[model samples]
Target: MNENQQSMPPETPQTAAAPEAAAAVSVVALPWYRRPLFWGILLFLGLLLLAGWLFWKEWQQAEATKASVAAQTEQWREHNAALESFMQQLRALLAKDPCEVKQGLGRITSPAGVMWPPLASGADRSDAVPQKPGDLADKSGSGRSDTPPAPAQNNADAQKQIPPVPVQKQTPRNVSELMEQATVLVLAMKEEGLAMGTGFFVAPGYVVTNAHVVGDATEAVVVNKAMGRPFAATVRLVAHDNGQDFALLGVDGTSGIVPLKLAQSVSRTERVSAWGFPGAVTNDDPKFAALLKGDEAAAPEVVYTEGVVSVILERNPPLIVHTATVSQGNSGGPLINEKGDVVGINTFIKLDDASYRQSSLAIVCSSLAAFLRGAGVSITMAQASESAGGKQ
Candidate 1:
């Protein structure tokens, strides 16, 4: 029994020693660079480092995107605030219904609410009547025909048979509906005068001027420099045009003052004689004091200038027009003619910077006349004697 136990123990120890020796030999036989376990450990460490780098790069990108969003939000907030403020101011201005423009707005305002005279009790309030289109039988009430029909009237023969009436003998364009207009001078006390504009006489006293002028004027004074004497006038109704830059002035023309005539279908090149009393006709150039500058002004009478109409720019852009001469004080002056007719009002003068000279431009009174008519005033245009340009 003892010998058997000893042999078994030896066999067990031999088996253990043999397996250890074989493992050592295998370890020694392996190439130094060919360790699978070491290679696997290195690969695991490399994967961990690459994943960490990718996560860091993703985090940085998210941070950049968040910063960009913040900047945009700030900018939008500022822009929205500015827009809200502007809208509020605009609404406030619209509610005022003011006649004259504020400090910032200049002649930029539209021409509306112009008056020719001041309103007064028992004043002629004719401009309040809208002038309707001429009827087949004009205001004269002289039915369709004053003469007998031509015998078998061929168009050519009938024209010849109709003797032309002398211009002087013909009735005024619309004597039944004559309206007056006025001019308003606007000043802003401390600053230079505000907008100065033209107004037409409606009734005996109502005048229409651009509302912007009346809104700025502290006091308004009217003059009828027409009758070799300056007649002082007063103001009545004043309203501004909502859609345009126009004002209406009501004046009392109860005095025996004759209303001026309006020219419709006027020439773009009419030889006009613009007249206005822009301050006692100041003769800054004494040379032109005794002797007027142009042939139109005879006795230094209210500064008359000869200029042909330049343009009729209703639909044209760069509406700036041209004429012979104009000045600042001539804003509400009438553009007249040899026949002593009012054609337009002097508005603006474009300068020739290179030559240091200026050409005049008058806003044609056609549309203005219509506006006056709508405001209960009437205007009549005579048969145009001049062509579209250049008088005979």
Candidate 2:
């Protein structure tokens, strides 16, 4: 039995080695593509490569977009620079005075008659002789003066004695005539931009307009049909109080233009007319468009609108509310009575907050008179009776 067991053991060691080798062979026989460990490693490496490719592609796209945006930004910056340069040139062109240009061309002609003459020199005047009250009284011992009072001058004799006024030749026959001859277009250059409004002759070489029209400008141009050219004007006075809205301009040569008379009072419901170069009317006219576009030869016609005085507002710096149709360019125009006397200055329009109804507003003549008097402007005041008689 001991010998048989030793032979079996010897066989057993070799057999055990064969079985272990068979198991190893079975594992090696499996294909590498089918093996779980090999496939797992392959899948992980493929996923990493895919992620890297995606990241690189995204980075390249971002760079391209960034470059495009930079190029667009530079393009816009250049466009803005060009626009700024154009605006500067336009402003410089507008600043050139038309009156100065016309004067250089020798187009301005002086009127033959002088409207306002300079005061006589003191040396040219004779001293007045002082006389006592008693000297003219009872020199002949009579209570009444021996020299009978000169016969009361008749209208005919008065007419014959008085010399013909130079302005009489340019006197308008009616209201329509007066407005055409007196109203002027006021143009000025202000910090805000170009400003336009209406003005009228108050005296020889003197024009009245709204203070807002002149703004802070010291110079302006006044265009009138009678003058046939724009006259250079300087701002003489601007009311400090904004409520007054009055300005006086001293024109270079406006002596030939007829002056309008100022009424002392305005009556409610009275027939009135507003005269100006209203934008609503003038803007549509091609001639006026040419005038605005630097055509010095073009003349804008005056616009006349008829209405009635609605009411007189009793507020500080009293205002006149009228039905006369006034618009943007009507500021500083004259609001005249039927008798051709200026009752107010068209200033603005009030709009109702709810209904949006428009109400034309004007500066009362009384306030205008005060403003003129304070500024020492010589204006002709008309009587109520004269205004009534002159009404058509």
Best by lDDT: 2
Q: Could you give me the TM-score of model 2 versus the true structure?
A: 0.56
* RMSD, every candidate, angstroms: 25.0, 24.5
lDDT (tens digit, per residue) of candidate 1 on 86-165: 54553444333232314433323222232212111112222221111111101121222234433344633643575322
Candidate 2 residue lDDT tens string, 1-392 = 78777776444677669978888878847777888999899999999999999999999999999999999898878766765654344333323332232122222222323111111112321121102111111122232323454433553365357522322237677778889889988877654435678999888888999887777778877776665655667899988464678889987546777889999788778888999988778767676555443444566899999899888889767888899899767889999988889999998775554565678889888888888888898899998785653233
TM-score of each model, in listed order: 0.41, 0.56
Tell me how candidate 2 scores on lDDT: 0.70
RMSD of 2: 24.5
Alpha-carbon local distance difference test for all models: 0.43, 0.70
Best candidate according to TM-score = 2
Q: Clashing pairs in model 2?
A: none
